[model samples]
Target: MTTTQSLPHWNMDVVYPGLQSPEFAQGFAATVKEIEALVQLFDASHVEKQDVLTVDDGLIKTFETAVEHFNSVQDHVLTLEVYISCFVSTNSRDEVAQARESELENSLVKLSQLDTRFTAWLGSMDVEQLIAHSEVASAHAYALRRAKAESLHMMSPREESLASELNVSAGTAWTKLHANLTSQLNVTLELDGQTQQVPMSVVRNQASSTDREVRRRAFEAELAAWKEVAVPLAQALNSIKGEVNTLAHKRQWESALDASLFANSIDRQTLDAMLSAARASFPDFRRYFRAKAQALKIPQLAWYDIFAPLGSSDRVWEYSDAERFIVEQFGTFSERLSNYAARAFSEGWIDAEPRAGKRDGAYCTPLRKDESRIFTNYKASFDGVSTLAHELGHGYHNLNLAERTALQSFLPMTLAETASIFCETIINHAAMKDADREERMAILEASIQGACQVVLDITSRFLFEQNVFEQRKQRELSVEELNGLMLQSQRDTYGDGIDQQTLHPYMWAVKGHYYSSDLSFYNYPYMFGLLFGLGLYARYQQNPEAFKQGYDELLSSTGLDDAATLAARFGIDLHSEAFWRGSLDIVRQDIDAFCELVQSQA
Candidate 1:
């Protein structure tokens, strides 16, 4: 068995020697001072809502100065926050890190207030005129315009300020509670005739085990452990969702989903188009699921079997092998991407181990423009290798945006998944090229499993969150109610592909996405990213040189425009169902091939 100690831990020393080091302390103090200076700048410039129709040269210069200052301060603030989050996320039991995070959040209330005031001021002024007059404003035209539009839903300055102050104890606290509880959670199971307790993340990773009994035991033990902590987790969910609902109402948004649409910089038409195509592909996904069940020689797939390995592989995907495979596959597309992956590996940028107190799942966060850290709970499986490819894709995206200003690189979640998914495809496709029949079957199964999650499972999550928000508006939902809603969502989307008796009911507690108050409806963007990426990959296949030349530019410009506008640049119509279906067709072809392989093997 691989221990966490053997796996690589990220090098935070490059960012700062330690959280308590003098360099970090100086940076933190300097950021606070900068925030104070920013407030003074805003006050001196009278950066508030205005009734004037046009701006003079003097006012334009003031606006430019304020924009530049705000951008600089924001960059520093994000770096500090990301640095703290690295420690807090890696170990939930770190009291000092948790305290520091809370203190930081509290300190930022004033900055958040200043942001609200600035947005309201922009909302009241002629943003287009300002953009025309100032070079800085012109460069940040999209973000400025977005702020102006968002200001329509803003509360009074005092109200917004108060909300920001209270969030530290309210929504943020609840989110922290959820993270701490889930990270520290442990499941007890009997393996090899001995009872052992393992972290919930470790147990969850067993879902892909080739042994049926191990998967079954892990799933049941996971549910039992969650049941023990369901009450507090339920309260955490209610609090976060309740806060989101109240804020959405106060801000005058139509619904939580409506607010999410604005946050993602996507319109309703785009969402509808993507979902319409996803719904149409449900029958095909079910076919793949049923075929997997047949290959497993099961009557129907249980929830535990969703990620079960479908074919045998004599080779174990150790960490070193995963590293080599990813770099080799990435080089097939572009040298820049390949070099980025190699740097991440050699520079100790990934923390790939599961252990007590460490968070579940995986994410890649930017430490600076040119650097990023990836976290994953790696198991010795192909899925683990694919996860590395996915996150390195995110790192590559960050590298492309290195030259842009902080505000210019603030991409919406919808486009954030593009590079990650694209990189994942590269690795999957490359692996298939050299594999023997059995190896090919394993690779294809892993590929389709990912698509099913993005397409089928993500639909269920979208439905579940939508229902939760709607019900949460009326009142708080109990644990049983949340579980029931989860089961209903699974049944609705999974249909007959999964056994009704074996559906996972506690999924709401298992997934961390639901516990975030700041980002709601975090589910659908993944679907958008998957389909969009596959579509881009198809485009790349048609014209490799042209696509390669423009790919980095597209990533670098994600924050510069809305998702639809970016899609238009590539001649992809986001509003057209056919465009999304084209992406789905790629997955469908894979499903067809998978079904044929399963049948032949059977």
Candidate 2:
């Protein structure tokens, strides 16, 4: 049977069978009514008074209950939004489908005001009084603090209302335009002596092909195609950053980075420690890259050639084989995680097929409150199997957090990758043990590619963002200027080991992470996730049983604590270099084995 046929359906019936269902429509309508009704009780001046604790408590409880209800409304809509758009995004020429997507986003955008009003209400509260309220004290201690942090930067009620409304049409609308434009841009490639219109994802993926000519051609074509839209992309970025920086200043924030840090609930010290660990391990990545360049018989490694396969692996895993492999590898780490994966696959929870209109990448969206729906475009390759493991890891993370109150289940970005990267480590290590000499090279090379991107490449992106902010303080960057910043960053991180002549200049145009207005410094979190996960995986390997319990406890605590405190449970001092070195040590072993395997073949 096909993978789709065997896969289980996610449980959406608990909420509603469709958007038109009474429960779904009623919930959405009720959310609108609640937001509209809040205006009667909303008064900015009331928040400053003391002894109004009873009144404040009622407002806080009402808001929390309303929000909990609204989350289900939005979550259900988003599930449909992603499921439907994933199909449409795969096919660029479907204008009607694309129009429908715009409508869905517009409806969501209209409710953006609800969030603004909610924030304003929270801000108006007497901080001391808000803290004293039982419902506020328990459900949203962290959120309350974060809200206060932001509320200070906000304008008064009238100005804040105007700004929030303008943002939807100005900053948000421009970013969406950039997305729509980029998504429609198609690249034509010369494959097997025939001209084929390849999706952008396929073009990029093929840049990793064993054939050097194919790799170079794909990179050249992809970048050239992106060049057409680079100017607009640059404007999109500049406009968003301008608005963000201006707002930060108005709020009396020192910088956009400071504002983001407060919102993310992460300290600058933790960020510094994470960056220090990544940079210190740069040599390990450089060594791995140099080895790959040598194996490929290239004078210097170019950006496109980084993902080139090193040796042959005739192991073509079917979807079923990949499923079993992931389950077995996860079982070796923690049976709880393993059982979660097993049930997800067996219970029809995944949409795992390469269909015509399916989305480009994989993600796990939770179903109502208890389950998750995973989408995958499986190409039956090694990377596909790894992607499956990664997404399932996210599903299990959601499963672990499902029991938490609606308020507590929101995991921070840094801890978000814990499960996904853990699953990757497990599958990669298990596959390494039994593969033949050639397959070993393929596996090791693949491992290095992922590590370098997560470590070295992310470092470059982080540097680029830092440069953008520093320069933004002086003047806006043009397309050419942004390209220069991106390339300079590449040279800095990749060192003399890379062929600078063939570096990717269109990175600013292609990567959505950089363009996201809501998040700043989106790059470093990947490094944190990988290194932290590696540390957890190392612990698991040392004492599979004892560490398994420790690992679960760590994951559970992630939603409630910071990185340093969470790592403490595992006896890992995240502030110390020793913990980071322990993680990098795992990478070193793999690099050494890969070098040996390549030399033996030579």
Top candidate (TM-score): 1
Candidate 1 per-residue C-alpha lDDT over 1-602 given as tens digits, one digit per residue, 9 for 90 to 100: 23233688888888788888899889888989999999999998888776764677987888888888988898888888988898888898888888778778866888888888888888988889889988888999998999989999998888888898888788888888889999998789877788998888988888987888999999999999999999999999999999999999999999989999998989999999999999999999999999999999998999999988967544578899899999988999989899999999999999987878999999998888799999998877788899889999999999998888877988889999999999999999998898888888888899999999999999999999999888988899999999999999999999999989989999999899888888889899999999999999999999999999899999999999999898887899999999999999999998998999999988
> Candidate 2, residues 393-492: lDDT per residue as tens digits?
8888887777665455657777888988998888888887898777788888888778888888999998888888778877789989999999999999
Number of backbone-clashing residue pairs for each candidate, in the order shown: 0, 7
Where does candidate 2 stray beyond 4 Å? Answer: 1-112, 116-136, 346-359, 375-377
Candidate 1 Cα outliers beyond 4 Å, as residue runs: 1-5
TM-score of each: 0.98, 0.87
Candidate 1: residue 398 Cα off by (Å) = 0.7
Residue 597 C-alpha lDDT in model 1: 93
In model 1, the Cα lDDT at residue 48 comes to 77
lDDT for model 2, please.
Answer: 0.71
Instruction: Please report, as a residue range, the 10-residue window in candidate 2 with the lowest summed lDDT.
Output: 44-53
